[model samples]
Target: MTRFAPFLLLALVACGDNDPRYLISAPAETGTAGQVALRVATLEVRQVSLPAYAAEDEILREDETGALKPVQGALWADTPPRAMTQLLADRIAARSRAQVAAEPWPLSTPAQALVDVRVSELAARLDGQMHLTGQFAISSPDQIVRERIAPFAIAVPLAGDTPAEIARATGRALEQLAEQVIATLRR
Candidate 1:
C-alpha cells in the first residue's frame, strides 16, 4: 500500500486543473434580415488587425485603473485576427447582396472590392461596456467601386462581467459594425 501511495499521488497531480477554459465569441445575429444592394458583387476581406492585447489568446478586461488584465482560466477558442476577419465577412455577406470571403480570395476570379479593417481598441471596459473602435477601408483594383476609408466606434452594455457576457457584447458590437459596413457599401 505504501508503494502504491506514491503512484496515487502522482496520478492526482497529473489530473489537477491545468487546462484553460476556452470561450467563443458567438456569431453576430442576423439583424434586419434582408439583402441590400452593394456596389461590388464579390468582396474580399483581409485579415483583421487587432491590438496586441486583443490579439492574445487570453481574454482581457480593462480594470478601473485602465490597465488590461487577463481573465484567469479563460482563453479564446480561436485566433482573434482570423476569427474577426471571418466574422466580418460572414456578417457582411448575410446582410448584403454581395458575396464576401476572407482573404486568399477563394474564387479563381478576382474580387471586385477588398476590405481591410484595423481595430485600435476591443475590450470589455471597466464601465460595464464592451468597446470596439476601428477603421475600415474599401478599395477596388479595377475601379469598379469607389474607394473609401471609414472609422467606426461601437459600444455595447455588458449585462455582467463574466467572460460569456463579454463575448456576447463583443458579438453585438460586431453586428453593429457589419450593419455600418453594409450601409457604406450601399452608397
Candidate 2:
C-alpha cells in the first residue's frame, strides 16, 4: 500500500482538474436583410443526421487521412446531430420569418414544407479550418413534382489552433450552411 501512495495521489490530482465543457450552438441570429420574401408558410425541420464519428459528444478534428480524432479534454454539451438540428431550426425560422418546428413536430397538422439535412463531415481540419459539408432535401405539400436534393460545403478559418477557436469557427460554418439552405429555399 505504501508503494502505491504516490500513484494514488497523482490520480486524485488529475481527477480534480476541471475540464471545460463547450457548447456548439447556433450563431447569433442575423437579420434577413436583402433576403427574398418567404414562399412557404410553415416549415418542419427534421433532426439532422450525422456520421458515426461526428455524432459523438467529444469535439473531433480531422486528420490528413480523413479520419477523426477527439480533441483532448474537449467535449460538446450535446451531440452533433441534435445541436445542428436546433441550429438549423432557429436559423430557418429567423431567416424566413416562418414557423419552423423541430422533430416530434408539436403541431396538430403537418407543415407546408419539410426540411431534411444530413451532415457527412463536421470537424476542424489540421489546416486550421472548421469544415461543414452536408446535403439538404426540401419537400413541399404544394409541389406537384419531386424536389431535388441540394448539397453544401462551408469552411471557416480558425482564429487559432485552440479548441475554443475551433468551436467558434464551427458555429460560423454552421451559420453559413444554414444561410445557404435558406437561400435555396427562397429560390
Best by lDDT: 1
Q: Give the total clashing residue pairs for model 2.
A: 0
User: How far off is residue 7 in model 1, in Å?
Assistant: 13
Residue pairs with backbone atoms closer than 3 Å in model 1 (clashes): none
Looking at candidate 1, the ten consecutive residues that score lowest on lDDT are 19-28
- Model 2, 1-187: lDDT tens digits are 9999999999998888465777775456567764455567677889988888888877778767977878888887777777878877887777776788788688887787788988888878887888888899988877832566899988899888666887788778877877877776674
lDDT of each: 0.86, 0.78
Off by over 4 Å in 2: 1-18, 30-36, 63-67, 142-146
Q: After aligning candidate 2 to the native by TM-score, how far in Å is the CA of 53 from where it should be?
A: 0.5
Instruction: Please provide TM-scores, in order, for all candidate models, with all chains considered together.
Output: 0.85, 0.81
lDDT (tens digit, per residue) of candidate 1 on 27-128: 645665788889889999999999898999888898888899998777777788887888888889888888899998999999999999899999999989
Model 2 accuracy (lDDT, Cα): 0.78
